[model samples]
Target chain A: MLKNITLGQYFPGNSLIHRIDARFKLILTALFIAMVFCAKTPAGYGLIAAFLIFVVADSRIPPRLILKSLRSILIFIVFTAVLNVFFTKGETVLFSWRFLTVSREGIVFAVSMVLRIVFLIVGTSMLTYTTSPILLTDAIEALFSPLKKLRFPVHELAMMMSIALRFIPTLIEETDKIMSAQKSRGADFESGNLFRRVKSFIPLLIPLFVSAFRRADELATAMESRCYRGGDGRTRYRVMRSAARDWVALGAAAALTAGVVVLRIFGL
Target chain B: MEILRAEHITHIYSPKTPFEQKALDDVSFSVSPGELVGVIGHTGSGKSTLISHFNGLLRPTSGKVFVEGEDIWAQPKQIRRFRFRVGLVFQFPEYQLFEETVEKDIAFGPKNMGLSAEETAERVREAARSVGLDESLLEKSPFELSGGQKRRVAIAGVIAMRPRLLVLDEPAAGLDPRGRDEIFDTVRAYLASGENAAVVVSHSMDDVARTASRIVVLDRGRVALEGSPAEVFSHRDVIESTGLRLPFVTRVMHRLRDRGFAADVSVRDLDEAADALLRLKGGGGRA
Candidate 1:
């Protein structure tokens, strides 16, 4: 039942976005998110929206999959929208009921807040969708290499990230198996009171933790047996390099940021 | 009478997605009371998927499963009851052990059935004895047991439920010879006591050859062959083509038959093969 999670899932493709360097994609996504918050007018939001729509289309990831990720945060989005709509003060009130006022500016703030969140999620999902987990962590390691001189274990952190990414599906599968095994023994995880339901999960959780610890120990031993001491003197089989298309993508991102800044200043 | 039946069951995983796969396609089988049925297939041949349907653990995409003449899915909420009636011991069941003591672990199923503590303990003790678990070890935590002991405790957990139809997926996998023998012997004794039935999913022909009253071979999500051990092993070409290995004794018998000894290649056990050779020699055939 946990299979529907698409948070870190990657879709294999040969699209232009998929071919961009992982480092560039990460930078572009950050820049896109910054531009989203900087926009101050309908036209500016529309501009950023149009650019995002194009990027989504160019990435070639199915719209249904991108929308699936939004399901997890739907409640948060609604909460943010409601808070912005009722709390923001304005001179022009749109409605008032029992001292609960909804102002015109409040409505605009809510709409913009919702749009920015949705856009931010979709824009960031595009990066994960286009780039494999290993490459994404490799990019993070490369971008954070300067911190290593300050004693930050950048490579180890990246290795941990990749390992965690690698096991998400495996652990999910193990959970499914354990759930079935327990169910066969007449352990009911569904159809109980709130307290009873929480209590029922005890059977499932104990086994899951045991298996996870077992896997971690085996992995550590396997790595040690292979003489894996540390990141020093180690070389990666696949190295990241930027190409012409990556440069063009980075240039487009910079232009988008600059354009959003200008639009915010000029109220376009 | 048929104890459990899957009628033209078809299971599709992740339907309506790019990753959709037809794990089982129009596969059908039935187990008679007191019958021991062995399900053999190559990996991805739908062996695991097929057994998951027996107890309503998996809902069929386009077919139905009946437990003793009633459609199991007729009342979805009551599927939990069917689990007690059709106990399943999954592969590597040892990993599912979590109870503080072996006795409590075995009594888990009975407790779920809401049985009284006295009755639950009785069932747990009986199951432990049947599985050859030492009575002294019942007080210890399952985590403190050896690998084989842990596996037996997990199996006993289901056996304590006293299901009419017990389904196991590779129960003897990853075990030493003695461990495998003890597990199968426990299952054999369980079936011998009454009209209870079992379906053991395995890839090991030797284990099935010595135990199963019938065999079902699956290939690419379809029932490729189904018959008694002798009847199924006789079709060597079909079995080999499906990527299933025949019992070592059966293979040796086949080689003897090829050498013009006029021996029966349908033998599934060492004793039967020896007897077949002795019979041929007594008839003055070439050794």
Candidate 2:
């Protein structure tokens, strides 16, 4: 079947990082990504790596599983690396073959770019790994509560977002099952031409969409029966709160960002 | 005559991951030819997992599955042939129906079996007739049909393949009593000829008693018991302790036997029980 599926890959644990507010995490991840671009040297990238390792360790998810997530993106890393390696111009060339020249700077540039991507995926994965989608949506809604003042349907938007997020795994599982079912019925997907491949997706996608909407209908009915009145004064099962640990984590992120900025200033 | 046999099969989901679960732990069973076997288990007892292995849809984590004494996984790429040999009607298979017309949907399986278009059409009609679907409905889109009709259409799709073995996961689930009876009626006729065998994975003891020649009870992914309906149903105390109820007629008959009456322990049908009661009443002059 369709392995390598990481949708809503929540890692349940009683760790400090897992207990942190997901909204803060989402924001901090954005800030951390922005800071990755600010790093100008190997030492600065080292800081980012250290920070990622610290966060990952604090989340308490086994390294083996996180490495499994990284495996799928290996091809993307190589693709990005090759693009950067071939595109970067430098006066110093390490090797030249035909029209292709491998530069010392280009190799370093590719390695750094690939490292950035690896960190980017792993860092974002932390949010999903620690927080379930429902709790994450509630935190997002609560964090963006001020948007309600601007006539934005914060609750409705969060509800829609949560529903969409929730269905990612469900739809993936459904697509996998339908694909296998069709495969058993001799709907060839692998040994087909480009046109045939696209055509093959018709059977999979149509059934997937049909089942998804069907599930949505059933879920809405279930929710209505349970009296799921939207975010209008409706309390959550688990309230979003920022505890002392959240401040500590945020403080560490701020410090890391400041250190990176200083390093960029020095170009060291 | 044993068409399907899973020897020492074990399956684990999300293995080595934090959420790892042993769905089927060393479960083994064999289905003899023309035998209607009922598989019953509590939720998460690996009943669904077990049926998936019958048709090579799933491979065991360890151990072997043989279809008619041939290793289904001998050539990994040839697993599709095994699927055609064993038709599996997955739970809620109706949701998998995507063809524009009922005829096309029913033809899907037979066509997948590499049958000629004419042969596929013939099977489509035959299967539809077997399930009591009208020929006029063949032109209608499967989605437009009622839920039970769509269910039968999905079932007909699999049956049209004419697999040597048929495995259905809860065929009569969510159906009205009449709809349930109609399904079992078709299954009974299909099994009457003893040309093929079918396995029904269900939790309803009464339904199993009414339809299956034998029952295979599963507890925690192990085959707790596998025997003819009468032999398995005789262990009412063990069945009850596993959170499974005995067949309705069997419970009634058991109570009568407790009262020093020679009520037949094999009576699982209402009519049969009624007939037995009448005979007992006449012999005892209680009429």
Top model number, TM-score: 1
Model 2: per-residue Cα lDDT at residue B219? 88
Highest-DockQ candidate? 1
Q: Tens-digit lDDT track for model 1 on B137-206?
A: 9999999999999999999999999999988899999999999999999889989976999999998899
Candidate 2 C-alpha lDDT tens digits along A63-158 = 888888899888988899998888788778988888788898899999988888888888888888888888888878888899999988999999
Alpha-carbon runs more than 4 Å astray in model 2: A82-87, A91-108, A183-186, A222-230, B253-265, B275-287
- The 0-to-1 C-alpha lDDT of every candidate, in the order given, reads 0.92, 0.85
Q: Worst lDDT window (10 residues) for model 2 chain B?
A: B278-287
CAPRI classification of candidate 2: acceptable
The C-alpha stretches of model 1 lying farther than 4 A from their native spots are A94-98, B256-261, B281-287
